[model samples]
Target: MASSPNIFGKAQADVLAETGTALLQIKNSRRLTLEDMARVLGRTDDMVAKYIAGEAEMGFVAFRRASEAWPELTEKLNGGAE
Candidate 1:
């Protein structure tokens, strides 16, 4: 029988943490304030802060948009995964 892939594991947690950190780094490198990231992501500053703080995981759609918009940073965060 076919088996489902494990979606919740250390690897997933690592990916989330890495992605969150990379997002924050990108913002810093670009000299973008939290408000700037919020504007780019169409989210509130509080939400962007939460994302940067790793208090909230971005939904797949938002992640996709971010990945598309910032491929370099996303690639680093996602371990080069598309």
Candidate 2:
């Protein structure tokens, strides 16, 4: 059977939703700010804000830096307790 385009789009949206929520939660739990997250990703505050808002998708390098800086973020992104 051929997959519909909506299926792929929904999957991507789900990933973005999960990632954005995780980023927000982790930032709050660690008492971090947008500047802090941006520093980790080597991005601007607005860029990190976009990531947390689910307005932008974070690339692999950003994920790597975020995970390195916060092990909790890694677990959250991996769906917990990996």
Candidate 3:
């Protein structure tokens, strides 16, 4: 099967990539391992890795879990000020 081009284009892709990197930074700052993140989000390590790699989008529930686990994540995502 063939895939269609991404309608969201480069800008959205860039944002997702930056988000992934930021999420990784947050995990690092928390001194968390991928396993720890998986437990926090109720996801498998592979899925967590994909979220941190920008290969998969975190759903609202996962996002909520992540934000709950790291309140600073919400601030950082909202542009580094709360």
Top TM-score model:
2
lDDT of 3 at 65: 91
Give each prediction's root-mean-square deviation over alpha carbons: 5.2, 3.8, 3.8
> Per-residue CA lDDT of candidate 3, range 1-82, in tens?
9553453454556656666887898888888899999999999999989888988878889989988888888777656853
lDDT of 3: 0.80
- For candidate 1, the per-residue lDDT at 35 reads 84
| Poorly placed runs, candidate 1 (over 4 Å) | 1-12, 80-82
- Candidate 3 TM-score, C-alpha based: 0.78
> What residue pairs are clashing in model 1?
none
Estimate candidate 1's RMSD in Å: 5.2
* Number of colliding residue pairs in each model: 0, 0, 0
- Which of candidates 1 and 2 reaches a greater lDDT? 2
TM-score rank order = 2, 3, 1
How far off is residue 24 in model 3, in Å?
0.7
Clashes of 2: 0
- Candidate 1 global TM-score: 0.73
lDDT of each: 0.73, 0.83, 0.80
Error of 2 at 50 (Å): 0.8
